[model samples]
Target: MQAPMTAYKRAWGEASAKLIRKELEKVRQEGDFSEERIAAALRRLGCGRDHGVHLGHGFYSVHTGVACVSGRVAKDEVTSKVHGAYAEPQPGTGPCVENRGGH
Candidate 1:
């Protein structure tokens, strides 16, 4: 049997999809837009604002759906972080990686 989907997850997925579609449309509409400008536009589309979507410890996602963007962080911030508004991680120690049973 398949597992049921949670309301939060469903909503998040929908919103994320919408954001992506909107971004694509924007690109098609305006060819010269930069990544930062596109991200800022997404944030304005009910996604929230920049600086609120931190991925934790200064890491952030430049898009949506990849990370949870609720509570202190706004939806737009989450989107911006995913879109490359933040600095890249240092070489050695990367973000915490989850270990599965494999390998």
Candidate 2:
């Protein structure tokens, strides 16, 4: 069994995911899939600094205060999800697993 989720964790997890989705939408609209541009869009979530935000191989993983938000970004489409304490390992060379503290 797993420990109960803290209120803080639950709140931040949702908030971070929501922000990630919005930023990814901007990414789709902007047509700039560079790491710098994506990171800039997610700046409001306090990514790209202490909390790591890794972007590569068409995938991105951001370690927020309470959860890891991972996503795929394309020139015309973007998708995201908030990782739980132990999400399944992501394929390829993406940082989702590590960023989520899974490995």
Candidate 3:
């Protein structure tokens, strides 16, 4: 027979999922809910995924549509942070900063 706790766990998981989905819907309605935006936010949480579909090495948040971690980072977060496929800005690829300084 299945453990009694198994049913409880399943129920909690389902309920949590529903709540998360609802929050995600709210976030989507607020503003740009694109993958890029979410990925950026996830970076702050020390989580990221390539292609915005595959879980790299951290947790992904559907509610915020962002990558997230369960708790505070314990060490050098910069080197530890994961970058999504398009998360990191390609050097010399951006049009903002340039050698063309205002003359």
Candidate 4:
């Protein structure tokens, strides 16, 4: 027998979400949200150069292969979540994309 496609999608989504959360926490602790820092963090978490794009003004959009996780970066505040702007992420994906939604 074969597993359903939804199951695979959900698994990928969850993985993507987890990665985003993990990196975001580290970013928060570091207290730096510069473009370089954010991009490096996302890259460390498996985001390719093309996948992570800066939307300017501290806003960013990143696609982590299976799901999209994005948010804003500021000195006082930093936010990150999974937002399926480019494409609908599978169920269980987290939440933000600058151009799409969840800013």
Candidate 5:
């Protein structure tokens, strides 16, 4: 049997914030929404203007207890305030990615 992919999945299918940062660099978009256009979006998300890390096509920031990336996959996609945009992530919902601070 196979597990279904959930929205909780990272944009590039990786869990490490470091790895996702690498993949984010390859994304590119048209004018206006260019790689440099993430600042405003970050501010709009209340993540602050300084937290923005323009990664070609999205904005990313990792703080003490929060991480976020904003985007528009396509014009046809519904644009909305997507806090916790994926879903409520619960422990035991899937396999562990990294055992952080575990004894």
Candidate 6:
């Protein structure tokens, strides 16, 4: 059985998706749905930032065609590669940094 919060989140996610689709349709019919315009509409619909809709990290809007992390396939090769490097520390491959002076 799913927790109440999980169920609620799923429901909300679905509703938000529907809303986005509707807005996109409106934009298409109006022939004014540029990428920026779509992004603005999404923001107005509360689909960006700290909103519940997690459209992938670094993904600000849907006009880019980048779906949310949850919307991607768990076993997708591209997703696997991206997720693999998400948290691991990156070793310095450039010139060493030395502290010169402290403010």
RMSD of each candidate? 10.9, 4.8, 17.4, 7.8, 12.2, 13.2
User: Residue pairs in steric clash, candidate 3?
Assistant: 42-67
Q: How high a TM-score does candidate 1 get?
A: 0.35
User: lDDT for model 4, on a 0 to 1 scale?
Assistant: 0.57
Give stretches of model 4 more than 4 Å off: 1-7, 73-103
Residues 1-103 of candidate 5 have per-residue lDDT tens digits of: 1133346544323343433333333232333444454444343334332443323333243221233333342323312111222233223221211112333
Model 5 regions lying over 4 Å from their true place: 1-31, 48-54, 58-64, 67-72, 78-103
Instruction: Estimate, for each residue in 46-90, the C-alpha lDDT of model 1 and write its tens digit.
Output: 453333332333232332433332211233332321121113333
Name the candidate that leads on TM-score: 2
Compared with the true structure, all predictions reach lDDT values of 0.38, 0.67, 0.32, 0.57, 0.32, 0.36
Candidates 5 and 6 compared: the better one by TM-score is 6
Q: What is the lDDT of residue 15 in candidate 4?
A: 72
Report the lDDT tens digits of candidate 3 across residue range 1-103.
1122345454553454444444334434556455454455555443334322222233233211222112111122211221112233223322111123333
C-alpha RMSD in Å of predicted model 4 compared with the true structure: 7.8
Candidate 4 vs candidate 6, TM-score winner = 4
The per-residue C-alpha lDDT of model 1 at residue 86 equals 17
lDDT tens digits, residue span 1-103, model 6: 1112355445554554566666555555566534465556667776554432333232222211222222221112111111111111212211111123343
Best by lDDT: 2
Sort the candidates on TM-score, descending order.
2, 4, 6, 1, 3, 5
Error of 5 at 30 (Å): 12
Model 3 CA deviation exceeding 4 Å by range: 1-5, 34-103
Report the alpha-carbon TM-score of model 2 versus the true structure.
0.68
- Please provide, for model 4 over 1-103, each residue's C-alpha lDDT reduced to its tens digit, 9 standing for 90 to 100: 1123356555675677676667766776788766677778777866755664444466666655555556666656556665344443323332223223343
Poorest 10 consecutive residues by lDDT, candidate 2: 92-101
State every prediction's TM-score relative to the real structure.
0.35, 0.68, 0.29, 0.57, 0.27, 0.40
- Range of the 10 consecutive residues with the lowest summed lDDT in candidate 1: 78-87
Clash statistics: count for each candidate: 12, 0, 1, 4, 0, 0
Could you tell me the lDDT of residue 66 within candidate 5?
32
Off by over 4 Å in 2: 1-8, 85-103
Model 6, global lDDT: 0.36
